[model samples]
Target: MDNLAAEQATDWRIDWQAPWLAALRELGQQAHGLVQAGATVASGLQYVKQAHGLLPGWQFVDQQQLPVGQAYEAFICNQRCIPTRNNLHDFFNGLIWLHWPNLKQQLNALQAGEIESQGVGAQRGRLRDSITVLDENGGLLLAPQALCDALREKRWQDLFVHQRELWAQAQFLPIGHALLEKLVQPRKAITAHVICVPMVQAPAMCTVEAADAWLSEQLRSASCNLVNKPYLPIPVLGIPGWCLQNQNFSFYDDSLVFRASRTA
Candidate 1:
């Protein structure tokens, strides 16, 4: 299948989040029972992470020499959030935040050990998927070199300010994907590309549509190819409270509760 189709298909299992919870509880119970019964529990933890998104609480180093920890499982609450965990019970128990207290408080509680770890690591990334947009002149604005140049020049302070303002007003749209070679020089002109990060917002249902629209328009203006699927959810670790006020957020299923919505 093509890249666009591939990315969309990757989320096929997301819908299973609802029903799989019960079965996962059983599996975790059995595995913990087995581990408590003297089994090493290596494979069992992997099983739990796979079935439930709970990881074994370990680490792996990438080529960049950065250490990446394992998360048990991941779920998309909206277009731009996924929280991973290492334990099944802790992951499920987080659902309690949906009713009382608030997600932020729950997360704080989880961090403070008021909630269990479930062996999951919170891994979040930016720039969820790609999109293509058209500039006012109808020319594809293919040069991210401008952004790169701005960064190298230490003009990021200005750029960030501008981007932050634009993001406040614009929503991104998804376009189809192009080949990797299309992302580079010479051949990049062959087809347009759209890359986008969601307009960060709070964890509420009302903001969902607005966030989606702003992202779409911004991506289209940039002449990039929008991926057309749900925006890739970024993890909300250490993100400023203001950013979360309007964008969708989710981490581990239990933490998928909605936040207060913002007005346009």
Candidate 2:
């Protein structure tokens, strides 16, 4: 993320006000290269000062080491890599970086290439489009397995309506703010990877393999894809209160996501 912070750190006030952006809040603007008034972004990454390499060539630099507003942009970049338990935002980003370093590098490379070639403009090319797609819709919802089953099976009444207690079991692991935002307010064609974190018996525990298997299964047939063959497709819009407001159980009263639109 090229922090276009040309002005002195003291001159500009970055938006650190997003409450739901909890993880980012923990890292602060400086970590992600926003370069707020007081903090300067990292310029030179000191390998000795960093933790073990998370990506092949990239390592986690202590947020403290980075200068607030440094003009440093590279495929293998430095970041304030904290433990996931420490902060959700950093955790997910770190996980993504680890899982798909090449993709991340490619996207960043493309974004930079676009700026160099296209400059700041109204339209963007494919790489930017892919990055934006992943940035916005490219998120996963990590919930209890039972809750995931409810969603996958399209058990709207059991999941959202009749099963009041089940709602409490739902947990959204910080995949990405955009994904979370989409959950908060759904829209058409907005798809997310679902990671069913098991909150049940040991035998049926959720594993990465299981989640990947489910994803593959769903993709194999549109009939299996919840978004494609939705028993109720309002899920395409979102989990409810996503755009208009925060995720609220109260919003369920008039929720379009689980609002039994059919005569089930």
Candidate 3:
């Protein structure tokens, strides 16, 4: 389907009982505030991970090869990831540093061995709602109270009604098929930097246009010989290699940044 048509069909109707239905608005506001404060992109994401754990499906991995730091676990069924526990912890970690600067030093001292990295089992309370929303093909069509119960009790593992509907409609079109296939693909994640931003500094960010320009220029100036080229071309023909259309970038408050990893 065309972009306009797809958007029209993409209902923003809230399922009232969705776990985040109440806090979604506030999340938006807080994210915006962080952006306006000149927080870097990484910082904003860290903030969200803390405020709404696992909801956005983010995961954190440290670049270093320490067994504990290298591969932190996350739940990314299909192509979506909920969010990183490390980052959520980092939000509080940063706070502790603010109150007692020495605490950061103490933590850093144990960075290699002292920090214990482990997986947080998907919280049953939150997962219940997610599974419900994504499971029942007709779950979303049910009464708000019924839906609320499913979400509250963590009973959302059934076929998500909305996703099922999307899959059905997508089956008829090649493009839809391709998109759905991509969405369903098993996730392959990598370790990348997590730039942390505080809630206080996420508002007065560079305009999208300005950031785009800046990022493009940064890419253009990179030494082509360097294996790590900054920008990639979007999968479109007849476009210059330098066109900054290949990747996706977003903002949370004023803190918006992109992931650059050892692989890239």
To one decimal, what is the Cα RMSD in angstroms of model 2 from the true structure? 10.1
Angstrom error at residue 107, model 2: 10
Q: Highest lDDT, which number?
A: 2
Q: Could you give me the TM-score of model 2 versus the true structure?
A: 0.40
- Report every candidate's CA lDDT: 0.28, 0.41, 0.26
Per-model TM values vs. the true structure:
0.19, 0.40, 0.19
lDDT per residue as tens, model 1, 38-140: 3333433334445544322322111122224422122121111224232222222222212111222322332323113342324221212111121100111
What TM-score number comes out for model 3?
0.19
Candidate achieving the largest TM-score: 2
Worst 10 residues of 3 by lDDT: 169-178
lDDT of 1 at 97: 17
Clash number for candidate 1: 53
lDDT of 3: 0.26
Candidate 3 C-alpha lDDT tens digits along 1-264: 234423422332323232212223344345434534544223554575566552233332222322442322122232222222222233222222222222222222222121233233344233332222221110011112333233233232211232223222111100111111222221212111111112223222223223223322422464111123111211111111111331111110111122222342
- Which residue segments of model 1 deviate by more than 4 Å? 1-20, 45-259
Give the Cα-based TM-score of candidate 1 against the true structure: 0.19
